[model samples]
Target chain A: MISAVSAPDPDVYLMLRVRDGDEDCFGVLLDKHRNSLVHFLYRMVQDQPVSEELAQEVFLRIYRSRASYEPTARFTTWMFRIATHLALNWLRDQKNARSEERLDEQWEVADRKPSVEQRMVYQARLQEIRDAIASLPDKQRAAVLMHKYQEMEYSQIALVLESSESAVKSLLFRAYETLRARLAHMVTGGTR
Target chain B: MNCPLLSEQTSDVLLDYSAGRLDAARATTLQKHVLVCDACSAFLAGQAEVWAALDTWKAPPVSISFNRRLWQKLRFRIWKSAVPVAAAALIIMIGFVYDHKSQKSQMEIDQVERTLDDIQLLRQFDVARAL
Candidate 1:
């Protein structure tokens, strides 16, 4: 059971409604979280199709388990915990045979006309960044993605990763340290 | 202010500062320290660069059919689970019919046996009267 907080979370409320067979509430939850969840999975696995498939599975699992849904934590925390589990399991299964094809997949930004040189430069930088992220250990990769991209707080990330807050901090530190070493050439003295 | 890099536990202060998660007062303190502290300065600069580079890797927009496909899969799952139940119900109905037919056939056989017994008794009585 979720300990009572000062204010109830709206998503948790929606989930409770879903538990009571409110189909529309499920759709609301899906609309609210679909993009972020897909993006998170995309970053984790670096494959669009796989990410989308996994996100679908996540939502399906949630829907299937709605009968027993309990507001034990923040909705996103529970959602991301399931996502992180799937992403990690996928990475583990594909170890030593990771795909680089999706790394070269064109992003939406590439749709705008750009000079050939600029496009080349953009693709090169993107590849370097992706490779650096992909090079990290699976756990560290997950930690950095949640921390840097998702902007999840340490406690929330800890909950997702099933670790203590300090451990999460340590993971983020080490992961960032590795990224810093790998991408140090891109620094132009600009503020973050 | 003590440098955040001096200890493992406090190292995330630098990260928090870089990520803009530090409070205003602490951010100001870290900014001042970054000016004088080369290590923190370099760390912040590199982290910033990493963040900028990561920003370039935009996640592809989710497919337009994502929700549709998901709903389809869900419907399929419902069908998958329903198939077993439907089969069980059909089997139960078949069993009920088979049991009813067997009982009817047994009653018919009992009636035929009674008729044969009565015929044999009548034949034996006729023979006794002839004697």
Candidate 2:
């Protein structure tokens, strides 16, 4: 169990150790942040394998830039900034490549026992939410994911996205409004 | 669907409220206002559901070999990057050594030239005295 009395930011300390030639500290940092980073990339790009690849690239970048790592911000902020930049570039590349080849690979669904009808409904709803999120503009999508999944503060989201707190708030507001318009039926049982 | 009681700024306020970013005093005030404003209340409710549905969405766990694979790639990249740096340093070191040797030889050549000049001047004086 983690203690409530917050210790000094372990990620920063570990990063400093990494800067000082501790290869093991890099492993520790990767283990600590791998899930969150991968999940963020997965949500950003909507592709699991690509997410994994990009997450590895993000870590590689961190290792490469370790010599210049400064504790000016929370380690996660700097880390996510790198992840966001990579994910956005990947998205842009996908966009450019879309004209040449359609990336319509089917994602693997989770294995669970349910009535076929029930599974169909669940999968349909899940797809709807995923499509809605994927439809958001890149920056707004990033802001929403960082805020919702990461439980990051508006300030932290700003830091990751390189925007002001007010701008982050604005992005969240607009993103949620669009989501609300699309998914409100799920809540209110109203017609779309 | 703008409510009469809420203005455009209310959207920002409502988002902040739902995100738990509003302070206690403002949150309490918004809570009181939300009770009376059905449209804003419904909007807030929908946003809450969006949050809930998003929370339900989880990524599959990374493979167990993720760490091992990442470390391997990272090590390879570090070494690959070091090669160029090492080569550049080697080049710079060689350049510095060559420059130092050239400077020393140039100084020695100048000293020899000065010595020859001195020898020529002395020989001239001796020749003049003999004449």
Candidate 3:
């Protein structure tokens, strides 16, 4: 039996209220997780609009499954589990739809009128970093995003990815190695 | 403690160590190894730089209407899901009312039949007295 002194997760408490037919609780949850969820999905899909749509779907799914929700783990774990599943599926579908469109599109930099040389160099380095990350395998990219952006632990990442802790670690290690190699010149403040 | 040299398999230990995930005993062991190993030390430094750089790649802020649009969608979904439940409840309530009305009518019919039978018996007794 669990100890009473160990309080439940605040999100879990809200979710329980949601399960009991309190729609307001769902709004609270959505407000809390929307940014993080969208950001996570944005990193995963690299498309802001698509990420927002997918994040909306994630909330819809959570609400739909509210009645059957169990506090088996942290609410964020379950939430990300759904988000990751949706993102992977979306990525897979996107991959099949257009195989040649895998390159990262040029993101529009802010409209600051810096020196031409400085701007070009900055854009190139930023694009290089984005491209390097975009080139990672799907699982590796997901693992890295969860670790780096979400700041999730390996165990939590494994739960979300449906993999083992060691597997999550291995994925992150490989992912960082790739990033390190590609961005080594940047780290050393040298032009590639 | 015998410090094991870092290998391909143990390379992840550097990552875990850099991320501050190792337990005290294991962290002490890896720290000892790093102190003697230049390669491992460099690896940790490179990884730390990579992590810092990755931190700069922030996602753009979501649109201002994100919450409003999401709330709209959620409300629609809730309304959509409620339709079936409402219809089912209506059907159940209608069936219950129909069953209740039928039972009440059956009881009323039985009462009428008993009153008719008593009238018939009274007429027969009055005819016998006349005879």
Give native contacts recovered, as a fraction, per prediction. Answer: 0.66, 0.51, 0.44
Q: Candidate 3: list runs displaced more than 4 Å.
A: A1-7, A96-113, A190-192, B1-9, B20-32, B84-131
Interface RMSD of 2: 3.3
Which pairs of residues clash in candidate 1, taking residues 3 or more apart in a chain or in different chains? Answer: none
| Model 3 TM | 0.74
Q: How does model 3 score on DockQ? A: 0.30
Q: Which DockQ values do the candidates obtain, in the order shown?
A: 0.57, 0.28, 0.30
- Write the number of the candidate with greater DockQ, choosing between 2 and 3: 3
Top candidate by lDDT: 1
lDDT of 2 by residue, B10-120 (tens): 476776788788899999998998888888898888888887667556677777888889878877877997999999999999999999999999999999999999999
Write out the backbone clash pairs for model 2.
none
lDDT (10s digit) by residue, model 1, range B1-131:
45558355677888888788999999998888889998778777888888877877789888999888988988899899999999999999999999999999999999999999999999999999999
- How good is chain A of candidate 2, measured by TM-score? 0.85
Off by over 4 Å in 1: A1-7, A103-107, A187-192, B105-131
Which portions of model 2 show Cα errors greater than 4 Å? Answer: A1-8, A96-112, A187-192, B1-13, B19-26, B82-131
Please list, in the order the candidates appear, how each scores on TM-score for chain B only: 0.74, 0.53, 0.50
Scored on chain A only, each candidate's TM-score is 0.91, 0.85, 0.84
Q: Please give the lDDT score at residue A24 for candidate 2.
A: 90
lDDT of 1 at B56: 71
